[model samples]
Target: MIWIFIFFMNIGIDIRTLMDARYSGVSLYTLELVQALCRYGSKNNYRLFCNAFRSRDGRPPRFDYPNVSVTDTKYPNKLLNYGYFKIGKRPKLDRLLKTDVFFMPHINFVAFSRGARYVVTVHDLSFLRYPYFFTLRQNLWHRALNVKKLLQHAAAVIAVSEHTKRDVIELCRIPEKKVHVIYSGINERYHPLSAESSEARRVRSAYALPERFMLYLGNIEPRKNIESIIEAYSLYRKKNPQSDVKLVIAGSSAWKHGVVHAVARASGFFADIHFLDYVAEADKTALYSLAELFVFPSFYEGFGFPPLEAAACGTPVITSNVAALPEIAGGFALLIDPHNVAGLSEAINEVLNDKNLQQNMRERGLNHEQKFSWEKCAREVVKVFENLNSIY
Candidate 1:
């Protein structure tokens, strides 16, 4: 009877990331995973752990299912992190709740889990790879955590892309077999839209967007290579002086965003560039659909989601060939060297001018987007959990 109870134990999830009102890459991943797990893995019990004090809305994370429960604490994040990392003290998660396995959607974990096994999801190793791009505090936070030790101790590690898995193996020297490559899924609402659609027109009017514009969506961060995009856009305009196409950059500014704005302001065609900061989620698909072409020349990504989302909306993409971009967008979107301003500018011009190529890419992108779904991602993740159960 005791063995049977142990075999069918509850799973605890660290959902502290979801406490934020605005969803970043990791927050979206956590939200989608939790929703999918509740929908598909209803047979198993889940306990969602969150720091209620950190929640943007000051409300506990919501899970509407009989098999799921929420556990909230008012503990501050800074103190908790200090105790976990600096003091080497682990939280008594198993004592507070009878969970057999605890899964952290991100690298930040409660130092100890008593008897519960741990699984962590590593989105990217950007901080280690591009140290100069991150802020001093960001670098210090990662350094304090000792990510290599965390990866080594985890029972299983989930990598969002094959590129990230390889990086983990090479950089952290973690065993290859312990890391699982699970692709993130696009939301169902991101399907292709017609320019004449009501929602599309409404979004255009609301944002005052130009009719024919190239789009770049994501945070204005150093790693995003927004400065390169600005320069490339300037070059594109210079090469086609007669063209009336605009460049639309969406998303809030982050670390060192002044560089991007400075480049754009210095351009001869500064008026042709538009900045719509932090677009709402409901407007994203329509924004993608209305674009003449989507461009993402990022320096690095664990898995590039914006390009994938744009592709799902039937927009032709021109993305970087480096990192996971090629693996994710190859054969569907035009790939270019992110560091080469001339090459990126040329690719953008070529895609925008070629009607036949655009049609072909649209078809291929829609087909490729079909390969990723949250339900499928959830099923694969549950399999990992079940596999861990067999071992324990």
Candidate 2:
């Protein structure tokens, strides 16, 4: 008789992305995925690692679990990045974590040894696809990272969507067999709130949101197609002068946002457009639940969170048909061309006025939201790690 031993691996997790104070899509994925992993992969030892020269808190986040530990250093990021680029593979990150395998929720400046086994998550190749959409500094940052060379050495590449996986296989020339499509999940905290609920009423009062308003929440940047949304909303307002629908824009500002501000000022309906800047986490679901509609018209995305998130809150969504939007939101929300201002304006008018459509979308969205969760994402991620573990 043969006796087989079940192997449990020491998995190193890169928490460098979570060190930033800003709450971005990458940070959300990194933090949530790791939290879920700790819950589900109880047998596997996890080492959360980071490198920061200077931080306001001057400490890496520690987990309260026997299976998890934090191994970090106070080193200048710039110097370490340059050293990784110049020194070939002298400084391996896996050695520092001392794990059987390492996983990066998102790619950044990194170095590895000749035999280092690591899996990397690639969010999108928008920088490569739409280079002109980014600023010079952003482009330079992508170039310096040498994404192509890094992916070539990675043990596996996890894409947030099938659309991104194809981009990796074709653009980076990586084998299709090596790339995995693993989506980021909508938080369970995002759920439908009663309109009469105290929390909902508080969010409305805090934001000064009128009862009838549509929402466009995301980074204020060129790639997000905010210009066209403003133009469409302006035209819509011109058409429906008697309507009381306001547009609430909330999110952090990215690069070249002056153009968006200029367009908003010139729209002649600037007073009706409210920019809430950063929103508090507690108020997010309430705001979504209170909104008449949610609009996300980005030109491209590896995977979108807001559309599904809005749906989870029982709000209707109108998003673009291009890129992963169709794949992600086509079944639940109305799809519009990101560039067609007239069409978009019409879409907004149709959705705002059509209660039956809203009801249909709301039901579909709630059902769709159940398809993704942090537990599901983490389970899939651990399976990938186990495959690598079996080799060692």
Candidate 3:
């Protein structure tokens, strides 16, 4: 039997990481990886190591399996502020040597851990390739440096998309064969809703969602290209004055509210735009189902999730053709360049005006959604754990 220990950036009672977790893809990836490991750990022994960022929050998230054991620094809140440097040495990897594999969901400190083999998931190289996307202060996290060093030593790496895999190979200089492209899976919570259910109506009442709305789901970061998206929406509304299509932006608002507000208020189409900052997870499905079309024209993504989730719910998608969007959306989406506001507006108009095209994309999207599965992702990851024996 093989033993594995999974390392996440942070986990535990406080949920501080959870607040900003959605903005970081690794947060969700870490959660899903643990769930996958828990499901398969019965056949292959496994345990988990997570940063208890807070000591007394609540029960740590788990999959009702006893094989997963969580270890914290015991004083995570203090360590969080000071980081590993001030917190003294981290939990010793040497103690985990009995385990055959050390799996890191995000790059972090590495302990050779006696004879344990290593595997890591590189969510993206955003920091290395595009540090300007983040604030100057954030671009210099000590842990970020540590994760990079750890990656160089890992036996293999898992990239959520080929785009990210390429980024890793080019930016980190990791070997191409060592990188596996395993996509993230959409939550079962996201799907087309039945008309009989009050799901859409319930969400509308809660979020004050207007009828016939265009949706943009994700953070309000500059990298998400919200300014460009709003510019395109403004143009779309100008050409079609009688259009009742409201442009709804949903998800966590980033550090710069002024920039986001400026983009929204400057819109001549303000009356037709809506922003629901930080929606509840439970309400996401209703929101996706109610949208007229889902537009995710992000500048870049490791593996764009909204378009895939929208396609899963049978919503027509208009997304950037760049990076992982094409790979993740497969052939189910209407692709447009993120920088091309006119192209985005045209794609939006075509989907809204042409019912036949929308229906075609809806069917293709449903088929595309079936191509990804968390179970398959779990099996593939387990293969990495099993292969650690060869490295040893």
- Order of candidates by TM-score, top first? 2, 1, 3
User: For residues 1-392, could you state the per-residue lDDT of candidate 2 as single tens digits?
Assistant: 99998678889898887677667888888888998999998889999887776655533455788999987677657777776667754257788778888998887887777789999999999999899999999899999888998898899999999999999998899999889998888888999999899999999889888878899988999899988988999999999999999989889888988899899999999999888887866789999998999999999998998898899999999999988888888889999999898999999999998899989999999998888888999999999998877666
Which candidate, 1 or 3, has the higher TM-score? Answer: 1
List model 3 lDDT by residue over 46-126, tens digit each.
Answer: 555545544333335544665555554444434544554665454455363245566777765444544445678877777
Tens digits of per-residue lDDT for model 1 on 37-89? Answer: 89998878999887756455644457789889988777867777767767777
Q: List the residue pairs that clash in candidate 2.
A: none
Deviation of model 3 at 251, angstroms: 1.1
State TM-scores per candidate: 0.95, 0.95, 0.89
Model 2 misplaced regions, further than 4 Å: 1-4, 53-62, 82-91
User: Which of the two, 1 or 3, has more lDDT?
Assistant: 1
Whole-model alpha-carbon lDDT for candidate 2: 0.87
Error of 2 at 227 (Å): 1.1
Which pairs clash in the backbone of model 1?
90-112
